[model samples]
Target chain A: MSVKIEVGAGGIPHNRILIYGLVGSLVLIYLTYLNTYFQTEYFAFFGGLAAVAALIWGTDTIKHLCSYGLGTGVPSAGMIALGSGVIAALFGATTGIFAPIVTIVIAAIIGAVAGIMANHVVRMDIPVMIVSLIELAIVGAMTVLGLAAMACGTFEFLGMITGTVSFLGFTVQTYETSVIGGSIIAVIFMLGAIAIQHSFNACLGPGEQQDRTLMLAAECGFLSMIPVAIISFAFIGTYAALVALVISIVGWFYTYRKYIVLSKRDAYAWLDAKPILEPKGGA
Target chain B: MEEIVFGIGITALAGALATVAGAAEDTESDIGSQGDPNSQVQLAPQMGYIHRIFNKAVAGEPPAYGLWVALGAGLAWAFMAMQINPILAIVLGSALAVFVQGVYATTAYLGRTASLAKFGQPVYIDILKSMTTVTMAHAFVAIFTTVAMCHLIISALGHPFPLPLLGLVWGIALGAAGSATGNPFYGKERQYQEQKFGAGVPISASGNIVRYAEAGQRNSLDNGFFSAKLGGPASGICFGLIVFFELWRTVVFEELNIWGPIVVGVVVILIFAIIDRYIEVWARKNFGPYTAPEEASS
Candidate 1:
């Protein structure tokens, strides 16, 4: 049932995309900090775009893992990915010291442990399960952290800590920041989850093709930006929201059109008229 | 603070009294209508008290029962609003609602799984594995919508609404919407029976029984599509009302009380429920008995 393409068995080689996505997002994160300290919201907006790029990578990983037909199903992989991702992102963002380093190190450890548990303890039995889980976790975390940087206008540790409530009442003064900044986690979590999962789930069927599936992934990634854009309006301003919304619209249309073309190419038949139906038991 | 406490206590007491009265009336009607000898036994108090409470909260009729649960949830949130950070309050409140909904859905799923096991069918492990993810997705969407609405309120009013109270309102609205829209993917038995369950069970041995077992299954895609359609609008309205009231409170009525938004929410839910019922009927009449053209042709 798998379609083989010249590039690889799938339309795009997973490794190539994964490499591009990983390198691309890390660069964007660094740029986001530079812009926050130097330039304007426009540059930070570019950093937000990095999340979409990471989503494509995440979706590819999902497609790869899910293609094996895991007993737990596709969405479970998405959940596991996001679960580890959110924890990592939150941990990284909130750490007052060496935030980026801490986030990656912790996320990798958690992802590795989760992968081991899913494979050995739960006996999911898929050979690639371990690596897939680890990669998904890293990508998921990166996506969350990246988008959050865009939303909050920086990847710096201080601003991110603005709204956090300390359990020991040490940070009660930060309550205002908590109200404004805390909700960003929730937004990113949902958007990341949808972008990672929806692509494969929507496109899976007999005639499934890799390019089309990836296209759908792109569409979902853009769709996820709608909420981010709305939240941007609240946090940044109308200009930021407009920028995000415009990019999302353009991306969505481009991917959607490509998907339609691939879908048409893959179609075997089309029903132009409704068939007259006789009554069931014998009309 | 004392007045707030007193008001909450009074509202909760009133709601509780009304629920007890309603239950009594419902019990009488249930007995009269069922006329089964075991109807009284069915009414006998169950031992699993916590389970019973969850089942009542999560598994009742669509919007009506869901609204009732939301109302109770709102009251609970009101109590917590004064104590916790707004974000924390929302997280906790929504988490509680989602957990209840998850347990309720899982219970129904277990019953279905048990029935499949009885027939010596190979129940796919995928169903079990994906259950948590599905429930979480539904809950996550609810939380996102709620948070967005809260942000809108804060932005428009230039002040935050009572966090816990808003959370409760969103929780109930979204929770009820989640329950009402329901899972189209797994609810029907027939789809799996034909594709998965029928694989092992011999037709001769099962005879006409296999058809009976398969009767409950519906097309997963159709169910999913319908669910999204119904749920999207219901929750959208809930999100909208939050924005509307927040603006109203800011611009026109600085003193606009909590009751105003809650009351508006109830009316919107009622309208949606009525529309939902018609959609249900329409879907059953028109879109019922769907078979994939490819599958049919094959």
Candidate 2:
């Protein structure tokens, strides 16, 4: 189907945005880990924010790679990214060896190999395949780790494993927390997948622009935070839950407003002009 | 201007991070003053706002209704609260959500495109036809590989990788492999049609060359089963060998390093790749060229 929208002229290069997104996500994730380790009750709110940043980064990566037209649908690309990401994240978390670094490195390596296979072996013929896949993998790993950390309030090896087990409803034979916290990772993983994939899938067209797509990304990111906030309410304290709610609201409002402005600016001539043709006599 | 917007976003994020960090530090000092965790306030009202905003944003859009999203979230939470197996809850809940949304989006897209076709816009029916067939085949391969990976991880290694993680790993690996393999296999079968825009024309026009095209004649069920049949055993054996080697070295030889397993894994993958190459060649030679009944009669 033909897309009606027009691509915008020059704007910030996607690579630059991607770089900033990656740096920002990594910093936020590290800070979240620190905060969760140092301060327990307030980890949820900060960690949730970190997850939002990761979502933004991941969505931007999707927008970048998908613009090249992956022969395997956009959703498929997203699933691959998340799939590699979750595995790497679990391995790192479970193995107790520099979890974040390991996760990022492994995901990147796997993604790169997969990209090469797609290009040479499968012969998909997408030029930016390798770099894009690597970026997608790294960002996807960050997204999963960030969200999982937020859910469990820490990314430490023992805490993450125990959190995961608890979330799975398995008893440690010695319980610590009253509520199951690890199950929230499943929620975050699914929501993060949707947020990253939906922005580009929904906004794609001739008129697809970075600004509008980013706005949609922001919206999706905020929407995904709702479940995180609810989970925080049950596990974390009231203050953390309230903070999540507030951040989501403020973020949504800011992004939605920007979307309206960009949409208006990008509006077609027919959007404002009156219809010229009247209904036929048959009507 | 784009740089400026990105800069602003970064700044805003930094500011928020600082605020949260400060608050966390303060909360740490005042932990004794905090209220009971069980007496925490409900999140329904805030969640309701999120639902409303999401609904408004996705209004009239197929597959992403607020109700379904809310229901999915609720089911996940409820399942967890009830102490249901976390993996089962997530899989079922996510599956339900995705299915509901997929149906809605597909229906809407098809309905709108069909209407547009009446107005003279080309509706590529073959695109949809191929998608269904391809997705079914890929799903089978992916599921089989996942099961194989899970068995290898759990039964052999004594490490119980969670179902969710296993699902993601095998799902991605098999999905990518299928896309890589299926594209070339099918690309060889059909001739590419020129189109003005949007990827390529997905039409199935007659081509003069028909060598090895019979592969396309197989039904999706047959194709799916064939892929699973080849892929399942290959994955199982590869993983089994890797795990067995690792176990042998770690348990019997008292070697704790992972290099043995890594090397074994690589060797297994190489072996599988070679076997796959042979299978492809055999299939191409045996399937023969496609000949339409009409073409043969003419």
Candidate 3:
């Protein structure tokens, strides 16, 4: 019976923010399905926004789970979440209209089993580990699904593996896209894992606050979107990928500036280092 | 029906291979002191505890393996497309991947240690020369087996996703399993053996890893010996079960409809959740609280 450690809070409860993240991400990602109707990949940038939301939710779960003295489990938790997520996301993509909902169910199941094994077998004894794991897994799935949608313009497994190219609004060529073949999915996996995990790893301590951490999470998400948006050029086309890149840069800038402000506010004193006067003694 | 049976066979084979890969991955990570616990190794030097632990964390195991396996599988896939022999391509691909792993390990070890030079930590070239090969060797086995498993899933089982994608997914899963399941055994049981067993790491002792061995000062190599006994195999079983159950659910239930596996998966998760709850209660009853009654109440 280890005592659970509590993370500090800002104005809002983490759970409420978590709901915002979950619902916001799911809704935005589901919007990408509109591409099926529009016959264009213009809505793909919404997937990047969805990833940002999922990453925010994931960051909170990690903070909550690691608050229980998980020592070094922070990054591991992130990887595990994304890892299990890839499995669930792939499986879910096989389903037609039910991809998003099915992804949640499968990811939850995988996360639950992994969480159980961690508690009962590994015996970390963290009270919130199971629920946190389940949430992280879903977040991870959404991150993967979101990024894949951003890159491939669709989360369908077949859609990911195949693509068509048009020149100046004229049909030109149909070819196999490299989302899966060239291992762009691998890029998405690492990007999402790092973006989701790096937030807490970078900003954890006794003085850590939720608003600051969540701000960083949002920033990390947008930073991650840069690469995905670039990759989206091959899959989603020039104009759609350009829109994603523009949105990613704008979102990233806003969050980054907000994060810096939050950091300065929480900090006791902020100082810039003076330039080194030439070393007094030679090496 | 035959396809289902064949999927079962492939899943079994993949599971067995995942078991081996999982063990090797954890062992290699333990040898390198790479992951959450690596932070402790980094902090030890700053705390004036200069030790010879091989601190080579290029990234966490999951993403690292994801990169390696994906690279290997991608190259192999390209070679296969070029009409090369599959077995030869796999070997070549894995060898190249292992080389990349070796480079990352060497550079990370050197770079981190050099940064700790301000703390009077010595750069032990011998440890670097010796441990890099050991980690890379284990990494080769893990990477090879994982890429092979991905290949089997793609070619034999006819998984729609290409080899690189499967490699990425399973590689991450393999790393996750090892990190979650095996690392605590190394981090808590082996590294911090001075502490009582089953008592979780206290907040006060976050970066203070055990630096001494039974004989002399401890190193990551010694940690590997202890973790290989329990941690390695536990991770193996964890990963094997995950792969097996995941594929097993699909193979057995997907025929009913797309929802079949999802329904069954939900049921499986619910069952585990109940068991986990029971275990939590039992453990609490048996072990009692770490805090005093008054402290716990407060």
Candidate number with greatest TM-score: 3
- Provide chain B's TM-score, model 1: 0.38
- For model 1, the docking class works out as incorrect
- Per-residue alpha-carbon lDDT of model 3 for B48-138, expressed as tens digits? 5656688886678777777777766765664554346988878777876676567557545654554344455555666777789999888
> How well is each residue in B1-298 modelled by candidate 1, as lDDT tens digits?
5544443443334333232322221221111111111111111111110000001111222222222233223322322323445456445444544543343333222222222221222222233234334534444344433443443344433345443334434444443433323321222222224444324323332221111122532212232343344433443444344344434333432236646655656665688789979988998788555443444220
Worst 10-residue lDDT window for candidate 1 chain A reads A269-278
Each model's TM-score for chain A is: 0.82, 0.81, 0.90
Candidate 2: segments with Cα more than 4 A from true spot? A1-9, A95-97, A163-183, A269-283, B1-75, B78-298
Overall lDDT per candidate, in order of appearance: 0.48, 0.46, 0.77
Error in Å for residue B5 of model 3: 2.0
Query: In candidate 1, how many Å is residue A233 off?
Result: 2.0
Ranked candidates (TM-score, high to low): 3, 1, 2
Better of 2 and 3 by TM-score: 3
Docking verdict class for candidate 2: incorrect
DockQ of each: 0.01, 0.05, 0.06
**Each candidate's fnat:** 0.00, 0.01, 0.08
Q: Estimate the lDDT of model 2.
A: 0.46
DockQ of 2: 0.05
True interface contacts retained by model 2: 0.01
